[model samples]
Structures are given as C-alpha cells and as structure tokens.
Target: MNKKTIGRVVKYLKPYIPLIIISLMAAAATTLLSLYVPILAGKAIDLIIAPGIVDLDGISKILIRMIMVILLAALFQWIMNVINNHITYRVVKDIRKKAFDHIQSLPLSYLDTKQYGDFVSRIIADIDQFSDGLLMGFSQFFTGLVMIIGTLCFMFTLNITITLVVVLLTPLSLFVAAFIAKKTYNLFVKQSEKRALLTGMVEEMVGNEKVVQAFSYEDDAIERFDKINDELADVSLKATFFSSLINPSTRFINNLVYAAVGIVGAVFVLKGRITVGQLTCFLSYANQYTKPFNEISGVVTELQNALACAGRVFELIDEEPETPDKENAVVLKDVKGSVMLKDVNFSYVPDKKLIQNLNLLVKPGMRVAIVGPTGCGKSTVINLLMRFYDVNSGSIQVEGNDVRDITRKSLRDNYGMVLQETWLKAASIKENIAYGREATDEEIIAAAKATHAHSFIKRLPNGYDTVLGEDGGSLSQGQKQLLCITRVMLSVPPMLILDEATSSIDTRTELRVQRAFAKLMAGRTSFIVAHRLSTIMEADMILVMKDGNIIEQGNHESLMKLGGFYSDLFNSQYKNV
Candidate 1:
C-alpha cells in the first residue's frame, strides 16, 4: 500500500474529529478499566481469601467494587464501537459522494474509454470493504496499544526481573507478524485488482446476454468467465491463507512468554521476594500485555487489506477532470443560431487525422443536411459543435463567437438534440418527457400528438403515467424514438440536431414526425444527419461530405445536376428504397 494513499484515506476523518476523539477516549478508558478489574480481583484474594482469616464485610465491599468496574468497562466498550461505526460510515459516505461527483464532472471522452463495471465495483464493493476494514483495524489498533503499554507498566512494578523476560520474548511475536504481513501485502493488492476485473467481466457479459444467446456463444462466454473466476479464487485463497497464519504464530510466541513468566514467578515466591497475591497480580497483567500483541497482529492484516482498497479508491479520486471554463467566461444570450467552422481539424487520436481544414458557414434558420458514408466525420462535426470535444486546430463559432470562449452549459443550452440512440430514465412516460423541467399536461399531450405518439400512449393501461423500465424496455424502437422526439419538441430551442431521428418510425408515422419537425424548424436553424435521400430532399442546403471534407454543396436540384458523388449517393439510396 502506498503511504500517500493511506494519508488520503486518513484525511477523510478530519470532518469527524470530535467523534474520533470521543471514540479514542472511550477505547482507552475501556482498556484501562478492564485491566484494572483483574488487579482488583487479585487484591480481593489478598484481602478476603488468601489471608489467615476472612473478613465478610471486606469481601462484600470488594465484590461490589469489581462489579461496578465491570459495568463501566462494558459501557465504554459499547460507546467505542458505536462511535467507530458512525465515524467510519460517515467517511465512507463522503468518499462515495466525492467519487460520484468526480464521475459527473469527467469528460465524455473519459467515460467513453473506461469500463462501466469497474466504476461500479469501486463505488460499491471497494468502498464497503475499505470502511469495514478501517472500522475494525482502527478501533482495535488504538485500544490494543494502550492495553499493552498499561499492562507492561503494572507488570514492571510487581516483578522487574520477570517483566524483563516478557519484554525480551515479545519481539518474537512482532517479528513473525511483520514477516507474514510483508508476504501477504502484495497478494491482497493483486486480489483486489482481480476482483474488479472479474466484476467488469460479469457486468459486460450479463448486459449483452441477448447478443450472446442470439449468436450461440454461451459456451465461449462461460469459458471466459470461468477463467477469471478461477483466478480470483486462487488469489483470494493465497491472501487469506497467509493472513490466517499471523494470529496463530503470534499466539504461539505469546504462550511461550506466558510459560516463562510462570517459571520466574515461582522462583520469586519460593525465595520470599514477593507475596503470592503479588505474583497473581503480575501474572494477570502479563496475560493482558501478551493478548494485545495477538490482537494487534490480527489488526495488521486487516489494515493492510484496507489500505489496498483505499489505494484503488484514491486512484479514481486523483484522476484529472475536464478542464474548467475560463474565468468569467462569456454566457451566450438570445442566440441567433448562426454556426461556422473555419479551417477546423480534429481526430479521436493524434496520429490519425479524421477531419482537416473543414470549413462551413451556416445562416440562422437555414435547414442544412449533412450526408456521408461511414467514418466520414459526420457525427464528429456535431460533437465539436456541442463542445463534447474541442477541435485541435482552428475554431468553431456560434453567432461569430468562438465556442471555446463560451461556457459549455451556455453554449449547449441553445440547442435541442435527438440522436439515433435514444435514452429514457426509468420513470413515468410523462415524467420522462418533462425530465427535470416543469411542463403542463396539455403541452405534453400536444407534443406527443405532434409526433403521432398520443394514440399509443393513451391505449396503455395508465396512459402517460405508466412507469418505464431500464431504457424504456416496454416500448418498441419506434415508440422510444417518438418519445425522444417529443422531448426535443417540448424544449423548442433556437436550434435543432436530429441524427436519424425518424429512421425507426414506420413510413406512415415518419410522415407525421417530419410534418411536426417542419413546423418546429420553420424559423429555427436545424441540422439533420440523415441516410434516407427522401428525408433531406427538401433541405435548403445539402453538404455532401467525404473523407471529412465537404466535396459538394447545393440544394437537391443543383447537386444532382453536378452528377458527382452526391448524385450517385442519392440515386443509390433512392433505388434501394
């Protein structure tokens, strides 16, 4: 485990300092009281049992004191546990929240490249293990140290010679513990990494179960899962086996110390150097001292595991987030939706250029259509316009203002978008349409009717109130597309982006959707990314893109008159349909 990672974990406790202090004090008091009770018991024997004659009054008083001390010890122990739980879980909550917020702030590109299940494991399983281990390790570690030191002080007062023997033998247990811990630390780290990998595998396979069954790849999928599962089991077993040896090894050394104390105490008693009562007290303190060593050894293993988990959590927290907006950045107002790209260049990777020297000037309220084959940088233009990614060279401007100079939120707020891949939350159809904004029921119904969705929605058991499953599972592809289109219609932004927005709807439904879009786009700038030639035949301007550059531009008549790539593309699709 890295020291920096452990330090980061400890920093989370700063907010709960008062609770931590109380817990520590309670732990100390609990250990001290429990240690003192054994001494009280020994004195009772000297006063009431081991004496030449017993005194009933003295015996009764001593018994009462012992019971009171026991009760206090129990009370303190309960307090320590309760406070430890509160502090640990509170820290866990903060860490999880921080991780989640960081995820929200990360760049879309970052989320695109990482595995989804790894994030799930870190937020849920890893954090849970870290908190549980820290709760046990911290409480036991502090109390164990206090008990060991307090017991040693009492032991020295009774028999200096015998105490020296215990001190000499104590290092054996510590040495054994340190050796075992050193050997198991790397194994625990490896085990944690493997567990995360295994979790990601399970998530990916389960999420794609339909695809697997359709292709009859069940045997292959099972083989891959079994391979990872077996590796996880093997690493876990090794780590557990090594950690399990720590307690017994320490226990063995502590037992030897216990035996030597007995021998030395007998020598002292026979030589008349100490009373039998003092011998009994020293022996009890000796047990208390050695027991902490054993307990602390167990805590060492847990602490190491906790640190391993903490390291993973800290790694996620340390990731650099998307660059912040410039200080006092410009906020667009009353956007006219004029967009331009001047000598722009971009690529998902640096070595492979996808878009170079791309230029366009679009007027407000113009219906523009961008058409291209696969991998021709069609959607890449939309990504740059939205600032989901920035152009590597040159500039993209909205209303003649460079997009880079504007706050992302303010720039994106002017445009409403519906993509080929539609998304809906697990909520009622009405709530999903409204999303976070307020909408009148009449307005929602009007939007649905415009997209030819009102009839199907009303036929459902609860109309707009029916709750959706994940990704709106109850709806067909066309129905889901209609809902998404309805969302964009309700927003009614100054600009629109429809990427295959009506491709899933039936021909009859597509006509209604296109009519609704025509009404919505009457006075607003609209960019339509479409494959069907019929959808964009009425566009005010058509950009025929190939290899990231616009090779031809004009309306349908002028482009077909050129008899170029656009003409071929239009004729091919027109014939195919």
Candidate 2:
C-alpha cells in the first residue's frame, strides 16, 4: 500500500468534514454506551448476589438500567452505520465523476492504448471495493479504539495489576495483525490487477464475438479466458486466505488473555485482595478489552484491500491530460477553404517516422485526391489537417492562418469527415444524422434523400424515429455508409474529407452517392483518400504517394501519359479486370 496514494484518498474526505464529525460522534456514543452496559451488568450481579439477603427491588432497577443501556447502544450503532454509508457512497460518486470527466479531457494518444474494460473496472469495480473498505474500516477503527480505551480504564480502576498484564499482551495482537497485513497487501494488489485484466479480456472477446465465430476460434477464445480466470482465482484465494488468518490468530491470543484474567482473578479473590464484585467487573472489562484487538485486526485487513483499490483509482486520476490551448489562441473564422502544409513531419512514435518533409497546398473549391498504398500516411494527413494530431515539425495553415494558432474546436468546426468505419449511437436514425446540431424534419429528410438513405429508412417500422443498435447493427453495410454520408451532408462544412467513404456501397449505389457528393463538394475544398483508381479519375488534382513521399501529381489523363507510379497503379487495377 502506497501511503501517498492512500493519503490522497483521505484528502477526498476533507470536504465532508461535517459528515465525518457526525459519524465519529455517533461511533464514540455507541462505544461509550456499549462499555456502560457491561458496567451495569456487573453492578446488577453485585447488588443482587453480594448482599447476605437478596435485594429484589434493587436487582430489578439494575436490570432495567442494563436493558436501557443495551438498547441505546444498538440505536447509536444503527445511526453510525447510516452515516458511514452516506459518507462512503457520496465520496465514491464524486470520485467516479471526477475520473470520467478527466478521461474526457485526456488526449487520444492516452486513450488509444487503454482498454475499455480496464477503464470501466477502474471507474466502477475498483471504486466500489475502495468505498466498501473505507466504510468498514473507518467506522470500526473509531469505535474499536474508543471501546478498548474505555475498557482498559475501567479495568485499571477495578485492578491495576490485571490491567497492566492485559496491556502487555496486547502488543502480540498488533504484531500479528501488522505481519499478516504486510504479507497480504501485495497479494490483494495482484488480485485487483488480475481482475482488471480478466474484465478487459471478456470485453474484448465479447465485442469481437462475431469475428471469433466467423473464424471458428471459439476454443481459442475459451482457452484464453480460462487462463485469465484461473490467474484471478489463484490470486484471490491467496489474498483472502492470508487476510482470513488475521482474525483467528488474534482470537487465539485473546482467548489466552481471557483465561489468564479468570485464573489470576480467582487467586486474588482467594487471598481476599479483591472483592468478588470487583473481580467480576475485571473479568468483564478484560473480555471487552480483548474484543477490540480482534476488531482492529479485521479492520487492518480491510484497510489493506481498500488501499490497493485506491492506488489503481489514483493512478488513473493522475494521468496526463491533453495539452491546453495557448492563452492567445484565436477562433478560426471566415475560412476560405485554402489549405497549406509546409515541410510537415510526424510520427506516432519517435525514430519510426511515418510522414517526412511533406508539403502540399490546395486552393479553395479544389477536389484533391490522396492515393497511396496501405500505411503510406494517407490517414495521417487527415489526422494532422483536422488537428486530431499536430505536426511534429512545420506548419498546417488554413487560409494562411497557422492551425496551431487557432482553437481546436473552431478548426474542427469547419470540416466534415466520413471514414470507412461508421459510428452510430443507440438513438433514433434522425438523431444520428443531426448529431452535433439541430435540424428540422425537412432538412433531415432532405440530407438522407441526397445520400440515397431515405428509401431504406422509410422502409423501417418507425422510419426516421427508429432506434439503432450498436453501430447500426441491424443495418446493412451499404445502409450504414449512406447514413454516414447523410450525416456529413447535413454538417455542410467548408472542407470535406472522405476516407474510403463509399467503399461498402455497391458500384451502382456508389455512383448515386458520388453524384450527391459532387454537389456537396462543388464550392468546398475536398480531400478524397481512395484505393479504387476509378473513383478519383475526374479529381482536379491527384497526388500519388509512395512510402510517405508524393511521387506523382496531376489529373488522370496527364498521369497516364507520364506512365509513372500512378500509371502502374492504375494499370494494375484494370489489368485484373
């Protein structure tokens, strides 16, 4: 357990000082009440049995006092529990909200490498375990301490020698608890980490279950899951087993102390050094004193578990977020659609340069096509242009204004994008198309019609109001592409990027969508990244790329006449047909 991380968790409780005070007061009251009950019981025995003649009225009054004390103790315990629960869950809610919001602010580079299930486990499962541990440990720690101290003081008053003996034996319980906790803390940490891995594996497998079935890899998937599940079970067993030993070990020591109190008290009574009533009270106090040792040991185990969970949560909270915009960053306005990349260079990782010294320019209303083989940095160009990533060196400017000088939101606002992968939330079809902005029913239907999505949408049971499943699961690939195109059409950005936008559509349907796109691109600057050579034959400018370098540039007819890389690529596609 990291003290620094655990300290950070305690800092979250600072704002709830008032609630903490109330809970502590309730715990103290409960402990005091419980301690007083034993005293009343001891006194009742003395009042009735110590006298030569039984005092019936006195016994009844003492019994009433003892019952009232016990009842009050139970009530305070319930109140303490209620307050602790409130404090614990409220803290957990705040932590989850902070963690999720922090995730939203984090950079894509950080999120890209993280698994969804791991994130979910940190936000939900880890926080839950942390909260439960805090609730258990916090309430018990306060009450148990008070109960031990009160019992010790009462026992000292009854017999100082016995109290001293009990105090000396008490260190044995602490030594045992600390030793076991040290051994189990690392085990619990391993268990928590394994649980997160198992959750990630399950999520990854289920999310790609279709692929698994298509490839008939069910046995492989099951084997992988079994390996992870077995690791989790092993770690969990070791952690819980070690922690479980704390209670019984402490209990054994406590039973010895109880026996010692009885034997020593009998000797004192035989010597007439202590009265029967006082001996009886010392025995009662001894039981009460030893009970807190067991409670403390149990709470120590819980604290270790809680700290393990809190460490994971704190690690997520402390991740570096996206770099902030400059103080004088300007909002990109009056965009003329002219774009320029001057000596641009970028790489996802250092020493593995993907795009180097890339430079390009396009005038307003130009239809520029970026053609390249896979991994030729075509998508990297789009990513840099949209400021999803910034160039490692050089500049990207829109209308002569450097993109880095402009706010990211304003820079992205001027572009519409459609990728090969379509993303649709579980909402009405109309909502998915009108995503980010409001539009009238007529405008929505018009955009859908323009992209040839209206016909199939109308055939649905609820038409535009029909809800979609994950990524439009019920829709065909062609239908989903059309919807994405419709989304871009409704956006009506000054610049458009279509990256394999209509790859899923049939040739016949693609032609119709292309016509709509031609109309959409009439006055806007456009970038088309395509593998099919025929799609970009009429593009005003075709930049042929090979290994991140532009090897050829011109219209289709000029490129064919040149008979360069572009001609060879164009010929390769037609040679197969």
Candidate 3:
C-alpha cells in the first residue's frame, strides 16, 4: 500500500525501540562477520594452491582467530534473535488484549450485526500474520541488505568490473519481489476474509447443534460445512501458490548471476592483476550477497500478509464503545427508587417507535407489573429503565434526578436486573451467584437458600463448588432460572426488574421462585414483567399495555372490577396453563 498504511504497523513497535536498536546493531555485526568467512577461506586455499613456502605458525594462528570470530558472531546472532522474538510477542499480546477489551465494551447493536465465529478468527488467525513480520521479515531483510552492501564495498576494492556483473541480480530481484508482493497481497486478503466466514459458520453450527439434531438436519449441516471448507481451500491454495513463486524464481536468478561471477573471475585471473586468493575472496563475497536475493521476495510476501492483519486488528481496536458518562456527570444520591417516565418515547431503530409518549410512575417500595403481548414494548421499557438504550424524546427520572445526568455504572448499580434468558458462565455455582457483588460464603449460601436453589445445589457432588458446564447447559431450565434468581438476590439492589425471569421454569419451581421474588421485593421498588396474568395477581399496580400505550392500570381486584383489558387477559389464563 502507501507509506501511511505501512506506518501503522510501526505503531505497535514504537514502545520497544531500545530492543530494536540493540538487535539491529547485533545483526549488522553478525553480517560483517559472515562476510569475512569467504575471505578467510580464500586465503587458506591460496596458501595451499600456490605451493608457496608459507609460514605455518602465522597461518595456523589466523585460522584459529577466524574460527573464534565466526563462533562469536553466531552467539550474538542467537542473542539478537531471542530479543526480537520476545519484543514482538509482547507487542502482539498487547494488541490482542486491547482488541478484546474494546470488543466487550461495544454496544449490543455492534454485536447483533457481527458473527461470533468471524470475530474469533480475526482475533486469532489474522493476528498471526503479524507474527511472521516480527520473526522473519524485518530482521532478515535488513540484515541481508547490510551484507549485500558491505560485500559490494569489499569486492569493488579487489576488482570493480567483476563485482558489477555479479551485483546485477539486485535490481532484478527487486522487480520480482514487487510483482510477487502485489499478487500475493490480494490472495492473502481473500484468504483472511474467507477464513473469517468459515469461522462464523463453525461457531453458529456448534452453538446450535441441539437445533440441528432436533430438526433432523445433521446431513444438511455437514453439506453446508463442506461448502465453507471448499471456499477456505480455494482461497488458501491461491495464496500458497503465489507465495511459493518467490523461492524458485529468486534461486534461478541467483544461480545465473553466480555463473556470471565465475566467468568474470576467470577473466580477471588471466590478467594477473589479482592473486588467486583475492579472486576467491571476491567471489565468496558475491555469493554471500546473492544468497539473500532469494530471500527478498519471501520477506515481501510476509510483509503484505502482516499489513492485512494490521488493518483488521486496528479496525476492531478503533471501534468506539457505547456512550459513557460525560465530564462531571451527576451521581444519583441516596435513591429511594421512585421512578417516573414523562412523555417517554423510544425506538430501537429511529423509524418505528416502540414506546410512544408513554407516561408512568413507580413510587418507592411499590410493586409494578408491566403486562403486554410479545414485542409490544414491554422489554423496551426495561431496556430504557436500565439505560441500555436511552430514550429518544423524553425524560426518565430516578428519585429526583434524570438518568442522563448520572453515570451508567451508578444508574445500573441502583437496579438489580434479571432477564428472561439466564446466562450462567462456566464456573462454580457459588461464583456465579456472587457475580457483580462482593459477598462472603455465608451471604452466597443465604442468597441461594432464599431462591430455593441451595437445596438442590447441596445434593450435587461438589455442592456449591461444582463446576457448571458451558452456559450452565448441564442444568435444567428450571434450575438455571433459579440460579439467575439467586444471582440477583445476592446483589440486592434497591430496585429490582424481573423480565420473565421465571418464564422457563417448571410450575413447581415457579412457585418457589415466587416465594423468592416475595423476599427480594419486600422493601424494594420492583417491576415484574409477566406474560401470564395469573403469575402477577398480587402486583400492587398492574399496568395493561397494548399497541405501546397503557390502557388500564390498578390492583388485580380493582382491574378485574373494571372488566377491561386486564380482565380479558386474566380470563385467557385458564386456556394456557
């Protein structure tokens, strides 16, 4: 790409400048030492080939010194390589951690449109491309360049004409590298995208394997997986083939240049200006320079792949999270849990309003039950109350303060929320129940006992310490909901919102949960959202909602006397249960 895009990759390495500088110096020293090896070989050959009366003592000492220098250079090279790996891995680790934290902070809408599998692949496989750049591309490419330049300087001292002929591969190698890099770049990009799609598919299938079995579509699912596998193969094949071109093409070009160097050397020897030893050393320098010629194209290919990954990772890290509190945001003080909505208006999307000009008030310690048909804005009300999404055109106040003025942490901390879906992380039952609240072992047991979950938990092999499977899949739905109830009771916020938390439970468990609810809502302002009217017969203020408007509201007895929407809803309850 352009200079700017390449600059982005350097951003991650800026923090490790000292290590990079040290490594560069070490690499240069190693290249210089390697270049001298051929010269030493040429000199030793001349001493024997010319049949001169050589000084044995001097020659032996020179050989020993040369061998020691070579060993020293190799030791330094190893040290530099170790440092390079350590720094690069640390940088990549930071990139991964920051990206993960940013993704978690993103709004629900951001997650709704993205696939979990695709996100996972980018976080893992895509970042690996950068590892190539760090390990091989930068160090090898720069060190090779230094060796080539240093060899040219030394060879020109012996014979300029011969060195020029051998150095011809330099520009040719560049031409091939540029061409291969361009083509390989596109292939790697395609491979990355296809892999993400494949990852997304794998995640979806694995998460919903139950549904596939229930519908008897196991064969169809395999067929679909095969299609993704083929796409991944096609893209990966193209990238591998294009990247493979670098090695052979570069080697062939280098072999031809070596032959030219040999021919040039023969001509120089006939002129008798340089000794056999000098020509051999010159040839060795050219050979050392040309070896890296084959390596350049491979480095370019690696660089292209790394940049592709850089773009993906940077895109994720740059995503802005949902709106946080403003500067000097007011904190709601000593909230007595009096909630009010004045002319409230909201929509998940801008075009269709789910709650239109709605108004309601929940006094401190009042039990309000919100009832509506599915998607009639019942859950949206809870979403607004929790400030997951802000109201578009109205004010929702807690106590005497507007929700917008308070920090989200403080606002959420004031309310205990239990959603219909019980998402229990794979952890010990005690840890799951005490989540978001710092509680002692005694408090944890009390919360579980309060929800009637402790009785069953004690019967497990490990009791409270038993590890739950993924998403608590090992537990029955009723048990999962009981765990959720216990989770909220432990937090014990001043206000509680239960949006069908008992919906998936058995009738027997539901009755127990109702008792837990009674304890939880004792002195707290609570919102009980229920589809079944029989479940909420004891609600102090039963508000009936239809078409985004509250048509009737009163105590169960008072609403039944009115013979309105609540009465019709109560009458239909027998048909369902």
Candidate 4:
C-alpha cells in the first residue's frame, strides 16, 4: 500500500472524527461481548460433570447470560455499520465535488487534451468503486483486528502453550495475504485505466453516431471497442484471480493453527493440566482467533482495489488550475473598443509557430473584416483578443491598457460573440435568450424578431415558453443560429466577434439578418470573419490573411483595384455569378 495515498484518504475523515470515535467504541463493545460468549459456553459445559450429577440450574443461568451478551453484541454491530456507511459515503461525496470543481478551474489547454468520457468515469464510476472499498474496510477491517486481539487475550488466560503455538503459525497467513495483495494492486490499476479508455470510446462513438453511420464505420468502431474490452477483461481477470487467492490461501494456514491448538489442548487435558471444559474453551478461542485472518484477508483485497480507484480521482483533483489573475488587475469599464496587437507571437504547440510578430490597430467603432482560407489563423486572432489565450510574446491592448493587466471577466463583459456552431441548453426559449443577463419578455421578443427567429418560435406549441432539449433538439441549423444571434442582439456589447455567424441561415433570411446586423454594428467595433466574400463588402477595412500574415489590406473598392490576393479571392467567389 502507498502510505502517502492512504494518508491522503485518511485526511477526509477529519471532519467526521466524532462519528468515527463513536463507531470505534461500538466495534470494541461488539468484539468484547462476542469474545465473552465462548467463556460462558465453556462454563455451562463444565457444570455438566457427569450424566446424573449435572447442575441444570447453573447451566441454565450461564446460557441466559450468553444469550444476553450475544444480543448486545449484535446491537453494537448494527450501530457501527450505520456509522461506517455514513462516513464512507460522505467522504466519497467530498472527493467527487472537489474533483468536479477543479475540472472547471483547469485550463482549456489541459481540458482539450483529455477525454470527456474518462472524466465522467472518474467522477462517477471510479468514485463509486472507491466508496465500496472504503465501506468494506470500515465495516470489516477494524472489527477483525479487534476480534483477533481479543481472542488472543482470552486464550492466554487459559493456557500459555497453546497460545504460543497459534502465535508461531500466524505470520504464515499474514505473509500469504500480503504477497497476494501486492500482486493484485497493479493489475487493478491497469483494469481501472482500461475501463476509462473504453468509456471514452463509447461516449465518442455514441455522441457522433450520425457521422459513424454516414461513413459506414460500424465495423471499425466495433473492432476498436473489442480491442479495449479485451484488454480490460485481461487485467480484470488477473486482478480477480490474484485477489481470490488470498481467502483460501490464508484459510489453509489458519486451519493449521486451529489444528495445532486442538492437539496441544487435548494433550494438556489428558495430563490434567487443564479440565475438559477448559480444553473446550481453548478450542473455541482458537477458532475465533484464526477466523479474523480469513475475513481480514478479504478486506485487504477490497482495500487494494479501492485505493487504486482513489488515486485516479485524487490525480484529477490535484491538477494545476488556470493561472490566477493579478491582484492589481484593472477592471475595464466604459470601453471605447480601440484594439491593438503589436509584435504578437503565438502557437498552440511549441516549436510549431502559427502566428508571429503580427501587428494591427483598429480604432473605436471601426468594422474590421478578416478574410482567409481555412487554418490561416483567423479565429485564432479572435481567441487572443478575447484572452482565451494570451499571446506568446509582445502584447494586445484594449483602449490603452494591456489585456493581461485587466481582469478577464471585465474584459470579456464588453464583447459579444457569435460563432458558426450554436449552443443552447435544455431550457425554455425565454431562458435561453435571457442567459447571462436579466431581460423582460418584451426585450426577448424584440431581439428574436430582429434575428428573424420569432416567427418559427411562435409557431411552436409554447412559443417563448417551449422547453428545448439539449443543444436545441429538433431545431434546424438555421433556427439554432438565429437564437444565438438573438442573444447578441439583446445585449449589443460595445465590441463584437462574428465568425461565419450566418453561414447556417438561408440566403433570404441571411439578407434580412445582415440588415439587422448592420444596424447593430453601426457604432460598435466589430471583427467579422467570413468565407463568403459578399457578406463583408461594406466593411470599413478588409484584411486578407495568408499563412498568418496580412498579405493585403484596404476597403472593397481599393482591394479590387489592387488586383492582388484579395482581388482574386473576391473574383473567385463571384466567378459563377
């Protein structure tokens, strides 16, 4: 067992110390009462000296006392179980909540590299495994220890020779159980890892089932799933096979000790060193003493698996969160939306440069359109501007202050963003439109009308009150885009980012929405990224980017006259027209 991991798991028990103390006390009581019953039974047996001379009254009294002790032992055992369950589940709950909260604080770069399904398995499946292990340890492990110690004390009071024999043979059982447990731990860890991989693959395939079917990738998907499933089965079988060896292996050793005690005590009885009744008590204590070894061996097996699961959960909780904001960071307010990027360098991966020493300046209320082929770093520019990623070198400034110098929340509050892909939660239309802000029904309707979504919305059974499913279920791509557009129309932030925002809408609806966008963009600084050349013809300035550099810059007429890259791009789009 890892001492460090065990220590960390123990730390969660600090809050429940009082309950743990009470439970331990109950375990002690239960074990003591249970151990005393054997002594009472031996005394009742001693009362029957001969068939005709048996003391019925004394035997009857001892039997009554034994029954009372047994009942009290059972009651304490019940209390311990209830308390153990409470502590185990509460600890698991705390660990899960901490892991989930830490995931939210983790950097986007870190999240991008992880599998969503694996995270789900860690929070749900792994934690549940940890919970089971913890509960078993709490319920059985400590009680077994107490039983072993208590039985030993009772046996020593009867005879020293038999006690020594049992003690001498006990280490064999311990060594056997320990050896098997060490072998199973790593196998259990591998099993958990493979299970997570399988979960991630299943989630990915199911979530994109449409794409899988469209590409006829069913056979390939099944092949990949089988590969992971086979690996999981291999590790799980090894772990189960190793852990299963602990029980019978230890039981065989314990039985040897039991037989040794019975032989030694019987010899002592024959020589009159102890009576037959006393020999009977020694035999019962011998069985009681060795029985805990078998139970504890089982507990050890469960604990090994639990600790393995816990280690995975703790790894997530301990991940480094996104860098914290500076203590004296400025809060952006009353933003004029003048933006500047000077000598900026950035790359998603080190040693593979994407944008380098890029420089640009946009005055307040200027409409800047960035046109480029795919993978030319157009959306990346928006990412840097929004501080989703910081530039590797140089600086980006809003108004006159460096973006890093301003609080992220305050900086983002001044901008409205709409992407080609739309997002909607499982909620009513009114709730979705009013997300992140308070708005009246009147304001929601007006914004929806402006984006040309109010017509279809009213056609629904509940209109604004209609509760949509996850990601706007059954809504056409165009309808979803309009709802996203309505979100920005309601707020009308001082700055805007539109990355192919109307690509999903029909031409007629796109024309109507473009008029609405022109009205919305009249006095706001906007960065529009569009593949369609016609949409950005009226931009105050157009920048044509190639391989992360601005190859051409001018208005529509000037760029057309320059007859360079921008001219060719525009002409290509209108060639068919």
Question: Which candidate comes out best when scored by TM-score?
Answer: 1
C-alpha TM-score for every candidate: 0.95, 0.94, 0.94, 0.94
Q: Where does the lowest 10-residue lDDT sum fall in candidate 2? A: 42-51
RMSD of 2: 2.3
Error of 2 at 518 (Å): 2.1
Please give the TM-score that candidate 1 achieves against the real structure.
Answer: 0.95
For 52-157, candidate 4 gives per-residue lDDT tens digits of: 9999999889988998999999999999999999999999999999999999888777888999999998999999999999998999898888889988888888
Q: Candidate 4 local accuracy as lDDT?
A: 0.92
lDDT (Cα, tens digit) per residue for candidate 3, span 124-183 = 988877777657765688777777788888788778888778766567876776777778
Candidate 2 TM-score versus the reference = 0.94
User: Residue 28 in model 3: shift from native, Å?
Assistant: 0.9
Displacement of residue 339 (Cα, Å) in model 4 is 1.4
Q: Give the whole-model CA lDDT for all candidates, comma-separated.
A: 0.88, 0.88, 0.83, 0.92
| Candidate 4 regions with alpha-carbon error over 4 angstroms | 52-54
Output the lDDT of residue 34, model 2: 79
Q: Clashing residue pairs in candidate 1, if any?
A: none
